[model samples]
Target chain A: MTVAATSIGTPGDLVSATASDSALRRFLHGLPGVDQVGAEARVGNLATRSIKAEAKRWALDLAVRTIDLTTLEGADTPGKVRSLCAKAIQPDPDDRTCQSVAAVCVYPDLVAVASQALAGSGVAVASVATAFPSGRARLDVKLTDVAGAVEAGADEIDMVVDRGAFLAGRYGEVLDEIRQVKGACGPAHLKVILETGELATLDNVRRASWLAMAGGADFIKTSTGKVTPAATLPVALVMLEAVRDFADLTGTEVGVKVAGGIRSAKDALRYLVVVHETAGAEWLRPERFRFGASSLLNDVLMQRAKQRTGRYHSPDRVTID
Target chain B: MVRRPAARPVRGGERLEVRKTYKLYVGGAFPRSESGRSYEVLDGRGRLLANAARASRKDARDAVVAARKAGPAWSGATAYNRGQVLYRVAEVLEGRADQFAAEVATAEGLTAARARRAVEATVDRWVWYAGWADKFAQVGGSANPVAGPYFNFSVPEPTGVVAVLAPQGSSLLGLCSVLAPVMVGGNSCVVVASEARPLPAVTLAEVLATSDVPGGTVNVLTGRTAELAPVLADHLDVNGLDLTGVAGDAALAADLEARAAENTKRLHRAPGAEPDWTAAPDGPHRILTWCETKTVWHPVGT
Candidate 1:
């Protein structure tokens, strides 16, 4: 329950001794490949679940609380980060029925500002580190990035996996890098972003998901929101399946976070359905599930307004951050 | 001749008439009023006609949002394509003429002949506006003679989302006259139908949905103008107002225009009295009312 200061496990010993290169390869490759058409069909089917009335109201509120409200712009200033923190604290200032989001995700440099702004608020400050969006920087630079954010009082650190190492069949190197970032994150919980768009296949997504969870990722994220096809239903489904399988094998639960392109209350509910049916109801908690999105919060608020007032809401009535 | 027993009702072959449950048209979907309240629409002789959705102010705000969302794509569409789409609305309306005429006759207490004339005039007005969709820019825009060696031209662009209060008395003809011109220049609109006679508006919305018009392009809400107009007027996102329907209530009209000034929305105040919609002009002025003139300058080569 207390993810902020608790370390999940030690890095090298996290996986079994059988995680040697060939052994890891055999384990990863032997993991079942996904049926693309079947996966897509399942996602489409789950999307049609008509969540209405009380269920819709509950989903909307939970979605607001599950959001990792993000602002990762090159132009993000302290003022913007502070306002985002305020938004995370009280999403709908006009209506008190709305709730605060889970976290405020910003670049590493603005972690302190967000942490201070959201000091008393239950919302956490999550930082995107490890040369985020690319993960192309050297291992030492990535570690410093992690350490700096942890020093700035970040409760959570979202680090990207090195796609170059993974695509080149350097699976051990990828696992090792995640371990290094996890080690650098002293008390901060770690979320390993797969950036599944660049990973090329469902098999790659599955392997990366297992690799991150095996490397002691408190949560495995879908994307950096900088890539096309980020955080899709099938990819999230694969990650969810991986976490479920990993828990079955090791008895440790690693959470799942789906980021990017998820803009509507309907879309959030669909992902929640995937989480519910695939990973069970336990993963429905904020500590276990998160949506790394900015616009998604507003949509959830709008839907909540509709539910409360029994009328469709306007975007103008909500703040335009 | 067939005889039916009073107790047994032996005439079992009689067909039951299925009446429609008129609802508010938002985002191209016919959803009942969110408030779940309905009011009886009656014929002029006070006979029960059907129950119409009593749309709330929330519905008005929703209509504005839908119109705003539909504004860009509808405006970016080619003028020729827009004209064709508008023409298709007229085509669909023509096919449903009998239904519209019946509703008009019942709502207005008009003779069948007069109701048919109203439908004809409404269809003709659409065709008129359809033709102007592509031609209005040419007549309204111009190549300005600049002071320096520059080629400057002014072109009309849609003024975003406009909110219209459809005439209460002339529900069918007046609705078409006010609605068509707002859309001819590519602006999307949220229309509050005639309070007492909203059946025609709902029927027209059905026609629009079946035609080539995109979802959210023209949202129709059946509700009290006094209750809804204030919301639309104060809605910061709405870009323009057509107050022709509020001509009879001067105080209400003044209040709405003042509230509209909060966002400096473009106001088309109601005329002293509802202009004879049957004799409404087929000119470029109405189309240009909700348009912004954009001027571009390019340097001339030697």
Candidate 2:
């Protein structure tokens, strides 16, 4: 959707709004008290801008990943997956002359291979398991999958929360499911994926977020990167509010990961700022947050490298997935 | 005067001789460090006196709970009431000036005369920050320039828990310098007091307890700075850190900063004393720098 030159994304560009939509917007803008007309404009500006000066760097960190691996096994061969993961993980690991991108996400089964490849490396090992994309299997099967992945040495466990129950409004059950998966992870961190597209509305996504925190999920993520309507700012804002609300209650930091559809540096930065302004200044660490996009890695790496060398590497030049 | 009774000091560590035991001063009662562990501190002559706790990570966490539990009502207390509590602390310090002076002398490797000045400065420092409890907002707030008919002003608020590294040489005064600002601003502090002599700090905490300064407002840990500062910096609940003592050690400072970055605790790097803690007046910046910013909202014309 194309936004106007002025504040935030233009609603007209998104979809034609009925009178109800306008009323809700007015109510939201009218919050804290009646204010000048610029209230809506300021809120919109905040939606797009970083809350702090360091937020852009944090946003840049989430977009890129170097799949630190030598081999892989699957429909995508180990070598090819390693290259893909590297593409996902890199500006260039041995740029010996420079710095690079974020992390390299790989399959839980390939964790040993990837860990060996990325050993003595800065790029972290993030694995996708716990019946990712579809968390409808037996609970034991999910726990074993999580245990096996952590045993194989994954730094981050991106598990899919039980969407079936969440869609059915069994919020507690979905939260319990995440708790069980987290229990299986001895020391490995947990990132719960809500798969925003299937959650249907922003409110449910926000509800799912609170439930995930109650279940002890370390980070709440969007999408499995296998669906549409992946990472919208509005949904992200709802999750950010969830994080903000939860932190005030628990004093524990919760992370956010905007996966799928986030294919560029700009969108990634916007997500980072939403987190910063909502979660306060604490959730700006890699261990607490990350991006799970398959296509955003190369762009972030290229952009990060560009800021230094005064030269932009073409998509082909930077070998990120 | 809160007099120190002459008692035989036990071995803080397994190796020691006569060393004094500093009871945990909570709500005005003197008790031992809950962990039952202590380390001996020596004078300039290398003569050991008191056995202060080798406070564990658990103690720091416990201290945070105490501070937070005591926050709402204590902070919500009228600034004047809080000021009255703080003012009493100065009176207590003044009464025990000689004890503090001797400890400061041993800890900072300074003359008895210089130590007396330092100890006295701590009392004087309290009076300064105490008076600011109510007046800070008057000096540090402003109305925004917006096209609006409503009245608005942005003022500083407290950041809650502060992890302080009390200055090594400046001991009592510097400890007061950091802790007083934190409390006057309604922030509770977990302090790693000077390693050489921690007696004065425990004494100060006693004074605080009796002065109505409230429990958990200042938790003083006397152990190894190297061990405690990093742990405090990395603590999840710590909102900010005063790194004044670790400024001389670049590696330690860097380690504290990097670990503190995990929870993104605000690290006020040393050179903390540049603003003349002795002469500086209290302002909102001192207090608000340590407060939580809670922006509230309510629907208009609901």
Candidate 3:
């Protein structure tokens, strides 16, 4: 019934001490519960903050720079990946001042193609591994997924945690998997995907966020873009608070990425506001905050065009990725 | 007897009448103008009838967006289905004839009998265009005899989204006359209602919403034609421009036509003056104006 002394030690020490199931459970359960209604209300109030004029311009460009342009499909082709990489490098082909995106995210097999296409361009290459949207495979298979993507020159590895085990209260098993995957990542940054939609509650999202950070995650992503209710505001708020609190406890600034169903420039601006209010203005940078989206980049680009031209833009004006 | 006299009815002063707020109809919902501006709509006698949403350039932009989004589904629907939906609108309008008649009377400053006739003619005009939904292509398209062994045929297709200016004089009948043809051709439209007389058009929007016609298929904006027309004409997504309401203003019409050329939008040039809506439609020319001729060549053997 006592809270574990997780805040007293470094993240590495915390990981070593909570290596056992009972210890990890006591720490996660002992963490304060999320006030669901309060979190939702706070997010709702923050979403209405009218970011306009110069602030909107800054938010749009920041959104462009923080985007991880993604294309993960069963029928993905090299041509598609190459075009996406082209878009990532120069999102607005006509506007040379538009900044390039942060990264291009794809599947493991397509990493090399994206890596080759985006080479010498400042855009990094990210790949989803560890059984991606569904982490239902064995630990070895999951590690192999990570290893393949890393070998293919993925600058960042986005691996999904085993939600089944975590939901079954097997917190240590999930932590062990994350640590093993982190070790196999070699020199690449590791982003842990909690797929918060499957977590079912904000309390579980907070618990899973701490678990991923404890297991050596460089970033904690919200979803895999394959599930409904992905990357909602309340859920993102909870995860952002977790990372903020974790950074305070360990002096390490872990990043947060909210993927899936975020398509509009308005929604992206709201996310930037949430990050600024919940975490801090420092997390507004590309290194600490990223948007995992494909269509979102185009929307932000269109909004940028509207701002400049003082006229509305149509979908036909932008390149189709 | 004293109690009966005391209970004599108070006709209109018994309670406060609920006044309707006239808002722009965009994307199938009644929303206030994005600019939050409304202008007084006056009758012929200069009496303020109501305040209509003074649609700004942003509202026009939004209406075009809604029309563009609705273009594919509306144009892709079977011609028969479109006919049925348009007919359903007529049926609903028929049921609301008394309400529309009163609105038309006040908006156009016409006698009660004349307004009733206009409303009746408007409903009939809808039925007339609804009948053409399935027949316009047959009358306009043809299979040409080519010298080669290929069957070459030309058929009509809806020209994406069209921006319309409803006639400024005729409130109900003329608005329906122009709108029914564009819709009959399967092209969704963003209509700028008659600036000074927009009450009947707003009432028509209520009928369109309740009918089976899909949302975003027909967006109505009530504001200055000079303000909204240029935005629509210059819009890249709008495939056609109907300047019927600006017929009397040659300078504005010329300006709009020049802007329409920027995007190669099909231009339905305004006439010298607003035409009488009571007259029968002049064949299927109006319907064909908003359609593109798509020709196909098929090998004889295949």
Best by DockQ: 3
TM-scores of the candidates are 0.68, 0.44, 0.93
What docking grade does candidate 2 earn? incorrect
Q: Better model by TM-score, 1 or 2?
A: 1
Best by TM-score: 3
Candidate with maximal lDDT: 3
The alpha-carbon deviation from the true structure for residue B120 of candidate 3, after best TM-score superposition, in angstroms, is: 2.2
Regions of model 2 farther than 4 Å from truth:
A1-321, B1-20, B24-31, B272-285, B292-302
- Docking outcome class, model 3: acceptable
Model 2 agreement with the true structure over B228-279: per-residue lDDT tens digits: 7866776656778988877568788888889778667776786633344455
| Clash count per candidate | 0, 21, 0
Clashes of 1: 0
Model 1, B155-223: lDDT tens digits are 999999999999989989999999999989899999999988999999999999998898999999997
**Over 4 Å off, model 1:** A1-18, B1-65, B72-172, B184-187, B191-216, B219-276, B281-302
TM-score of 1: 0.68
lDDT of 3 by residue, B200-241 (tens): 898899999998778899999999988988888878788899
